[model samples]
Target chain A: MKTFEYRTAAGLAAGLEPGAVFLAGGTNLVDLMKLGVATPDVLVDVNRLPLHEVSGLPDGGIRIGSAVRNSDLAADHRVRTAYPVLSQALLAGASGQLRNMATTGGNLLQRTRCRYFMDATMPCNKHRPGSGCPARDGDHRNLAILGGSPACVATHPSDMAVALAAVDAVVQVDGPAGQRSIPVTGLYRLPEDTPERDTVLEHGELITAVDLPALPVAARSTYRKARDRASYAFAAGSVAAALRVADGLVADVRLAFGAVAPKPWRAYVAEEALRGQPATEERFRAAADAELAAARPLRDNAYKIALIRNLTAAVLTALAEDVR
Target chain B: MRLTVNGAQHHLVGLDPRTTLLDALREHLHLTGAKKGCDHGQCGACTVLLDGRRVNSCLILAITQQDAEVTTVEGLGRRGEPHPVQQGFLDHDGFQCGYCTPGQICSAIGMLDEAGKGWPSAVTEDDDLLSDREIRERMSGNLCRCGAYPAMVPAIRQAAGR
Candidate 1:
């Protein structure tokens, strides 16, 4: 491996190399480097940029610094009490030691854990654009069934991000062209034609923090993941849902799915179906079916459609009950 | 970068950015107690204490960690006396292969510290010490292919004075 210039967060934009990548926790970036998928010449250390604070925003929302470790973010009193879905999503990811080291920025920018993406030998459009996607025909059981173009079919692997989508979180980024705000929904573009771009973030853009608007309905949210194993396994399918039901009528709701799409899929149609509807399993099932109607599954990934349907229905039903 | 590894200060000036804290410890410092089971962060074999917090040394960049008090397995015991965790592991026969032992010990220390700091877990109430089931959940990160969990729990429990 070639050595690169190392510097602190100061003058980060000025010091950017052609292939420079910010090194936060090195959980995903280092692994990608080892796999030859990412060969950055410089790795700027952003761990010491005084961005670890979890502060309360004026909108009654919370602003979480990018450098904050996943463990600290999950255990923060405000996060646990106010955004339990986000906390639960964080806890559901990787092992304890990894979460202890992984920062919020790194976690959000994590590459897919897909086998093809990690193996340089395999033909992957995401790793090497236009090479060809071998996963479409081989070992694609774990790949995406939604928002997949012929060029790519990989899924976003972070659990924390799925919860962020449901709550409509805003990402604050600092780049060469000054600062800009991106909604969580717009952060990840569908893999319609640009399979190479996982996120819409421009090059040299550094995520400073994530701004979360206070949503009381979101406080009742929960993240439930079904994995191959009990621990250290990526989600086979997962749901982040927040439901507010009053007198058996859905007052408000939000829904998002993970490990089922190229990005954290905000179930907009599903939410539209649930809004003002009677809180019941029939309505929940119908909502899930409507959102999944456009899913284009490969030969090996048809199981995910059932998995998402059942899981979404189950989570919505549980959230709809008067169990608060 | 200067590191206070196990209470000893050492300066490394011309290290590569690709060099992990694990490589620095096992190769340069000759502290091989923290085994490199998997070069990737999936395995906890190279676990160590960074400022008294447990982290995978294999993924940590040494240059990024300036002045961090790194406590490895070599630093746990006093001159001739074994650390309580070491003794506990021995008394309970926590390992048959012993490759993941150091990580388990260090991680348990870190886990106990976290519990004292009121960290929550799925199995127990927030901030409580590991219950019998919670022990398995908390230590799930440290994989022991030797199937020594029956004895390992006793060892960690003994060390924790439970």
Candidate 2:
């Protein structure tokens, strides 16, 4: 193994080292390294860099530091009370030991746990640029169904990012050009032309924190995931939603699906269709159908379209019952 | 890289950055109490206490934890005078080939700490009761391939002193 030079981040605006990747909680990075998928020359230690904080924003939202552990984020009082969907999603991911080690920014920047991407011998476009994506016609039962291109069809395996996309969450990044913020929805890009890039982040840019806006609608939110088993499994299909109903009319809603697309697939089209409409299963189905209509599922993952649609309706149905 | 593992400082010079903490503990420090079943964090056989929290040691690089205080299964207790979880495993027959026993013991200790700290599991809806189902869910990380769960649950409950 080619050991890299080690450095620690000095502060929030630390000096960036070339050929470096920040190491927070090595849950995903180290796994990829073991599989020969990622071989960083410099592993910058950022665990003791004083970025662990889950403070409240002036806008009544929450500002979670990038180094905040997933277990701590789920146990936070503010997150559990205000954004239950976020807590639920975090709890539903990985195992207890992994959750204890996984950080917020690490979770956000986690790579796809796709079997094909991790295997270096496989013909994966994401692993090797311009290489044929064998999963396109190979065994891809858990691959992407929405916003997928011919080059790649891997799903983002983070349950936390899916919930963040549901709310107005903004990702904070510190780079050589100073600090800048990007919406969580805009942070990840579809693998249309660039299948190698999982995110829109620059080479040396570091994610600092995530700012979730004041969303009272999230009080009645829920995150529902369906997989092969009950625990320690990635989602086959997942939904994170906040539905507010008024006299049988959909007052407001936010929706995002996981394990179904390249990024955390936010159902903005579904939200647009559900607004001002009656809070009924028919409306929910139509909104989900409208969103899934554009889905180009591969041969094995065509079931995800129906699965996501059913999960959307199910989560909305449970939330609608809360109104009654 | 500097690693203070189980109360001893070991400065491993020229070690590969890809060398896992599990390797540092077992190979370098010669603390073979922690097993390496999967080495991919799936089986959780490399579970250890990293700064008071249980984590898969195989998933962490030794150099990345320059300032960490690692506690392996050897740091828990001895054979005759065993830790509560170890004794529970012995008393309740929580092992078959005894390969995943160390991880199960350490994970049980971490699970108790998490439950005491008001951390809820996916199965824990409202309260943090140490039910059989809750224990199973919280201890899901440490997989006993011997199907030792039927005996493992009571042993974990015994370790928790309930």
Candidate 3:
């Protein structure tokens, strides 16, 4: 491993620096560095500085600091009660040890779990600029179909992030310039051309917290992940659903998918299709199909089409039945 | 950086900045109780307690934990008196190679604390706390390559006295 200088930042202002990478849990960054995927000359440790807080916001929402552990957030009573999808998503990922170390901000900032990205010998645009994505024609069973370009087809490997996007969470960030909040939907950008740039976070910018707006609708939420294994595995297809029913019909619905897109794919079209409609298995199937209509699967990832549709329909049916 | 490890305060300096808490504990401090399997945090062999919360030591920076209280497996049980979880693991034969035992025990302590605090797991209802499904879901992160899950469950249940 390459040696790097490390500094402990006193606060957010002290942490922002050129060529310095902010270290939260280091679960992803350290693993990448060991694999020669990411080699920073300097690491600015941000695990301290008093950012680890999970509290209720004045606007009846919740503000979770970037340093808050995934385990803590998942265990938070308010999150469990109001946003069960978020808690379930967090729990579905990694292991107890990892969730304890992984922070909400780090979970969002985690890189794609594409095998090509990790293997330095492989040609991956997301890892090495201008190299190209080998997974497009290679083992792409786990690659993305939505919002992917010829340059890259890597899927975002975050369960919590997908749930957060489904609920329209706001990411609070601090940078050398100033502080600002970006909607979680707008945080991730499509591969388009620059697969190297995964998120809209600026240089020297640090994610301070994530603010999830109050949605009573999300009180009846669920997250379901289907993977190759029953436990401790990455998702092949996952769905996060936050639905509200009124008068025997769907009042509101927020749906997002993982392992099928470059970012968390919010099923806005499906949500629109469900509004004011009777909550039925047939309607859920239709909504799932509507959301996946635009999916462009690769040569080997065609199974994701069916996997996503079935998983989405199952999650929606469970939500409709109020089965948690 | 100064930290309280296993109730003993130790001052460390001039260590590798990129060195993880796992490396610091096992390599530098000779606290070899926490094993390093799959150093990528996928395995729970390097689990430890930081400020009463269980975390994968492989993912934590040594410098980032300045002055924090750390508990390793060595600190978890006395030389003669083993912790309830440790005793339970031994009684239930929760390991074959015993490589992931320290992490499993450390994680179980944290998991029991979470259950005691009325924290609900994924399958838990919004109103209820600590169900069998919740225990299983919350404990899913720890993997036993030896396939000792059946024994591990009973061990954890005994430790939690559920």
Candidate 4:
């Protein structure tokens, strides 16, 4: 470990210093540093800056502080009531001890669970610049197919973030330029040529909170994750769905898939297809097919095609029966 | 920086900024009650109470919690007087190596707090209130390598008196 200066910031301005990394929860950043992936010379502790709060907005939305623990945010009554998908997705992630330490902001910024990214010796585009993605031709069974570029195919591993994107949540960020909000959909950029850049956030910019807009459809939401284990595992492919039914017809629908793209893969095309249509297995299957039409799978990832299809069908079927 | 560990207040400076709270408690503060298993956030061996919420100390920076009150396994009880959770674990034989016991106890304490707040788990229905299944689902984040989950439920339930 290298020597570094540690300072506890009093406010966002105090924390956003040059060459200083804002430390919240330290779940992802600390682990990356230990793996020799990230090495910061100065750490700005933002845990005490008073961002840890989860409250209901006057507009019937919810404002979750960036520093709030994943466990707390997932269990919050407002979140569970308004966004059940978010709660379920959070619970599907790492064990209770890790959820207690992981924050909403950190969870959004967590790196991919790619084995190549963690192993420094491996040739990974996400970890090493210009080294190329080994998973592309190698064991890419878990790699992304939707928004991947030729540079990399690493999938975003956050379960809660996918649900947030599906519900059109807004991420509040604070920096030297002042405060601004970015839609969760725009938080991440497509791999394009630079797969190394995971998020659109600028350096020194800190996430303040996530504001989920009022969505009545969210009450009829569901999140289902498919992984190798029954617990304590990352999703291989997951679906977060929010649907509203009126007179046995789909009035509104929103769907987002995780661990299938560089960011949360929202099936807007699929949602549009389901809207104004009768909620039936045939419609659900068509919507799933439409959403996965753009998928470009590599070798050994043919299983994701069936996995995502089944998950999408199951989540939509569950939501179709849920009362708004 | 100052920390009150095991009811003793210690003010120290010039420590590594990247050092984890778990390492600080074990290496510097000499409170080795919390063990370090994975160093990554996957394992629960470094669980401790920071402001009454159980957190993986290995994932937290020592300097981040300068003024925050911390409670380790050692602080939970003295040699003769054990915490209810600890006693529950002992009665249930919740460990073989005992390395994960401290973290399990601390995480259970936090899990009970979460359940008391009426927080829903993954298996919770939108209309249904909490049940034993919800409790188990909520507590799934803490893993026991020894496969003590079967015993853990009764131990936590007995400690929580539910």
> For this target, which candidate reaches the highest TM-score against the unseen true structure?
2
Q: What is the TM-score of each candidate against the true structure?
A: 0.96, 0.97, 0.94, 0.94
lDDT of each: 0.86, 0.89, 0.86, 0.83
- How far does residue B11 in candidate 3 sit from its true spot (Å)? 3.1
- The most accurate candidate by lDDT is 2
lDDT of 2 by residue, A35-77 (tens): 8888788777788876799998998999999999999999998
| Tens-digit lDDT string for candidate 4 (B64-153) | 777788999888877898888888888887777777888888888877777677766667665443355665675665667878777877
How many pairs collide in each candidate, listed in order?
0, 0, 2, 3
Would you list the clashing residue pairs of candidate 1?
Answer: none
Model 3, residue A111: distance off in Å is 0.5
Comparing candidate 2 with candidate 3, which one achieves the higher DockQ? 2
Determine which window of 10 residues in candidate 1 chain A has minimal summed lDDT.
A8-17
Clashing pairs in 4: A95-B141, A96-B141, A96-B142
Q: Using DockQ as the measure, which candidate wins?
A: 2
User: Model 3 scores what on Cα lDDT?
Assistant: 0.86
Docking class of 2: medium
Candidate 2 segments whose C-alpha is farther than 4 A from its true place: A15-18
Task: Estimate, for each residue in A184-269, the C-alpha lDDT of model 4 and write its tens digit.
Answer: 99999888888888999988888999999999989878899998877778888999998888898998889999999989998898
Q: Rank the candidates by TM-score, best first.
A: 2, 1, 3, 4
Model 3 C-alpha lDDT per residue in residues A1-324, reported as the tens digit of each score: 678888777668554556668888888998898888888888888876688999889989999999998988998889988998999999888877677788999999999999999998888998888998888889889999888999999999999999999999999998778899999989999998899999998878889999999898889998999998767889999999988877779888999999998899999999999999998888988988998889999989889988888888888888878742
